[model samples]
Target: MSTIDPTGVTLVIGATGTTGSRTVAQLTAAGRPVRAASRRAGPLPGAEPVRFDWYDPAGFDAAVTGADRVYLVPPVGDPDPAAVMLPFLDRARAAGVRRAVLLSSSAIAEGGPAVGRVHRALPGLFDEWAVLRPSWFMQNFTGTHAHADSIRADGAVLTAAGAGRVGFVDADDIAAVAVRALTDDRAPNADLVLTGPQALSHDDIAAILTDVTGRPVVHHHLTYEAQRDRLAAVIPPEFAAMLAGMDRDIAGGSEDRTTDTVRRLTGRPPHGFRAVAERELGAPAASAAAVHPESPTGAGSGGRLR
Candidate 1:
């Protein structure tokens, strides 16, 4: 629970989205006022729904007005989001919004690329701020992601990351941390890397899924170009290339570590892949059997982690 008393509503962009929805739920459950912003402005039980489009600046004022804080989820599929986001943020700053929490990716660093530009500019835009650079979401395997699709259809996890490990964190944990960042007496004022309790390779993930679901599952490795081409069929070519590049980087051991950020901020350990799998996958009689720990290791429908 936040010790700080929230005076104004927290504007939650992408309210119907993965982390956005969870963040809104957590906030409302904590008795905090929230304004849920999405393109459709879909209604949530305890939130004020407002229409907010990244390209539509006309609605920006309505969303920012009367809100002291903002949770930013960058526009999906935009090659350069800072171009759209920075302007709205400037408007938000002028509107008296004091705190901002941004959802970014561990793959990208401040001032590095893509949302990194927004990550770099967040501090200058708000007095209190936090940039969450989380690892790959565990929901990718259980949600409406490509990985899940492959799992359901072909009983396999496709990836270019051969033996590379990733500290896949849960979206629920990410939202919990975001809620704290928004409601805490003082902002972290720094970028935090969030991850699960432990790192697991794709092979390990396959084993866990097989154990939980009582079905055989395998990790089908693909070449970088192959994965890029496969992803390009659905998303933009450049973005597909970028995602494939992240996988290649993962293969090179880029996302091979875990952090205590989630525990440090939320006062609880992050959820493991197996727990997420059982809860979200709805596998009957999901087992808690242990698997052999090995090495490391998607673009899914849940949108890029960034």
Candidate 2:
């Protein structure tokens, strides 16, 4: 528990999603008030649920009302989220929101792509703010995410990242950092690069999966063009291309480094890939042990990434 009780009602956007949910849980556990905002307003144990949508401006007033801090999860599929989010943030600032925290990717930079646009303008928008640029998530391998079903069925993880290693950060660590940032009196008014303790390649991920799940999971490396083509069918062409390029960068060692931001913020080192795999996937794979298929991986549902 924090020695200082952080002030204000925190308005958490995407409260039902990955990092947001965990953030809300931590704040409530700390005895801080939270305004949980989502597309669907649902009952929460220690929060005030409000209906919210980034595309809908009508809800902005109620969402930010009496809320001094916000945890922003910009709408996905908007190639440029700044246009939609900036106006809302302006309204939020006008309504007395003093701090904000954005969920961004390690691959994104100022004006680069996706959350990068928001990242560039964050410091100027709010007096106290932080943009979390996290590497790939470990949840991708355990939950019903882009790679989960494929791994369950095919015993394989397809990637354009040939042998590029990534320090896959756990979502729980991200939530811990976010909650601290949201309520901290002295803001970390900077872009924080978060990662796990060590980096591992897709082949390494497969080996861990095999050991945990007791299945012969392997990594199928694809060419950039091939990977882009595969993703294009599910997501927009431009988005698919961007994702493929990210993979290409990964393959080139862009995300090989690890950071201590997680430990710095949460006062503990991050969970290693193998540890996360064991905690989240080991139990499930053991209950239903069987030989899986060999299906080619494709983007599934274009799920909202945190």
Candidate 3:
């Protein structure tokens, strides 16, 4: 395999997902060539959407073909992601993809428990790589989740994080920083911890939502056990346990700190939770009321480290 040119095509692994989609949009808007890799190869304006799946190793080469750089996001629900990601990174390197930007979680830094292993192993696999360790996504309250729907209905949020503050980030900002890393030679072989400008507790986030939507939104805290029970009813027990464990970590003051990585990389301070709330919750009853017709309960919101 020949060394990939820096100006060659950039492939986004999870093009349909929140961050990936925004990355695609930003890259395309900037007139950079992009190949969007997902399960489906559909018509995405200004991009060549291709089919790729992490579970199917046969499809990996096709996805990485002729790409210079790749944005790698592990598939959700994989208990051991490094087992899949490490080998895939090897293949991409072998296929001449020189630079890679990996979207890792802030909770899984070098010393952290589960996801740290991947964080530690990534830089060794490629000549140039960047690990994006971002905090909770602001999309949890706007996207397809019980929280978003509940917020639309009852104007309330629920979480197990009693008063633990989180530096929630906009997925768009994460994507923007990702595009810069993938395209610019300045970002290389670094681990960036990106966060919002300020740390805000769930209660603070609720207040912001109320102010943005002109509705009575409140934060309802629950015990870890109660949160686990609520999540287990919808997702698998193991996944629920993983989520509950994260919350336990948060409650223990694991993710309450703030960082300046976003400003360092993007030349702008990270957006605050109130700003995100305004954009997502500004429309008031029109968007929120369309969420659920059957359920009368308000939406639930909380910080989940992504």
Clashes of each: 5, 0, 4
Q: Candidate 2 local accuracy as lDDT?
A: 0.83
Global lDDT of each candidate: 0.85, 0.83, 0.76
How do the candidates rank by TM-score, highest first? 2, 1, 3
C-alpha lDDT of residue 290 in model 3: 34
At residue 218, candidate 3 shows an lDDT of 84
Tens digits of lDDT, candidate 1, 1-306: 232347679999999888999999999999999999999999998999999999999999999998999999999877689999999999999988889999999999999778999999998888799999999998777655557667766778889999999999999999999999999888898999999999899899899888787768899999999998988888888888888898898899999999999999999999999889888654442221212111011335423442
Instruction: Give the TM-score of each candidate.
Output: 0.92, 0.92, 0.89
Instruction: Write candidate 2's Cα lDDT for 65-165 as tens digits.
Output: 89988999988656778888999999999998988899999889877777787888888888788999889888787666566766778777878999999
Instruction: Highest lDDT: give the candidate number.
Output: 1
Note the residue pairs that clash in candidate 2. Answer: none
Cα displacement (Å) at residue 285, model 3: 7.6
Which residues of candidate 2, in runs, are more than 4 Å off? Answer: 1-5, 284-304
